[model samples]
Target: MERWLGLARSLVIYHNPATVRAWRRFYGQILRPGDLVIDVGAHVGTRTRAMRRAGARVVALEPQALFARYLRLTLPRDIVLIEAAAGGAETVARMAVSSRHPTVSSLQAAFVDAAPAAPGFGHVRWDRTEEVRMVTLDGLIARHGVPAYVKIDVEGFEIEVLSGLSRPVPMLSVEYLPGFASLTTRVIARLEELGPYRFNPVVGERSGFLWPDWRDGAAAREWLAGLPADAASGDLFARLP
Candidate 1:
């Protein structure tokens, strides 16, 4: 019940009309009618909502029980909500849960341990844990067909999720924290192995990309490394050559 209430509060916080509009405009540029999108870490389905509004068919993945229940009650019928975490393989895993800010709950134990020292994470705590079934990106593709875009925001577990992917899709995005350069570095390396991919960054929840043009992984890595230690978190966009 406490977790449910926390999730309710998060829905109110994230469902801001102005912010949602910005995301909608950004997503609208990428998703076309009938395009399929995989929304990993679909917490409260805010991004899923934007994707649907942009005319994409969505597969919303949320592992937390409280949020998954909320998604089932609120998400559109056309959007398929999967109650599982996307990881490197099919298995059972433990998730660190933050009842106060459920969006930061993650499957990466190291990230949880390192959170206190990271900017913007000092106030949050992993107060508890829950067991969740884990599925892979490859497994998802096998079941739902390949998605045109996959938006991953599983806290710091982005690399693990990418590990499940054996091939590159047309495009994908993963959340990143400037304080956790190593995490994004590994994510970029994994993507590079699958294909020749260019990268861009969208700092925070803004509608704009950080660079005027897409850059190679090396350039992107340099850019990430140069960010100030206090730089806010954002999503990194990766696209195939």
Candidate 2:
């Protein structure tokens, strides 16, 4: 019962109408009808819902049991909800869970270590852990076919998630934190190996990009390094040329 309350709070915060609209506008620019999208770390499926509204076929992945149950109950029949984590390989990984604020739950211990000191994350606490199955992006591609776009928000494990992709898709985005800027650079380095991908930044949940034009990986890395240490977390949008 207590766990349900925490999950409800997360749903309320993330499924707010204005935020949903912002995500819709941003995602609409990238998704098209009949296109396939893989949403790793789908959480409560708010972004999955946004992508569905954009007319894309979505495969949503969530590792946490409680969150997975919430998604299974609310999501429509067409959306594919996978109750497992996405990583560089298939294995059982321990997930540190915050019962009161489930969105901060992560598979990376280092992320948990660094979060309390980071602004906006001081209230989060990982009170417990659960072992969950993990799957690779390439494995998902093999089973579900390659996606047109992949949205990954696996906390500090973004690099591991990207490691699974043997080839680049049309477009993809990974969550980035200024507190963990170096990890974002590692993610960029991984993406560079996959394709000649250009990048842009979308801070927080904003509908607009930071730059008027996409820049190269080196430029993007430099921009990330230049950001203030307190800059809010956001996603790095990358696309293959």
Q: lDDT by residue for model 1 over 15-132, one digit each (tens)?
A: 7677777888898987788899999999888789988888899999999998899889988898999999999889999999999889999999899999899888888978899999
How far in Å is the alpha carbon of 22 misplaced in model 1? 1.7
TM-scores, in order shown? Answer: 0.97, 0.96
Evaluated at residue 154, the lDDT of candidate 1 is 92
lDDT (tens digit, per residue) of candidate 2 on 1-241:
7578888998888877777777877788878898999999999887898888888999999999999998999899999999999888899999998889888789888889998998778878889998999999999999999899999998898988887789989999999999889989999999999899999999887867989999999999999999887888888999987
Model 1 TM-score (2 dp): 0.97
| Global local distance difference test of model 2 | 0.89
lDDT of each: 0.91, 0.89
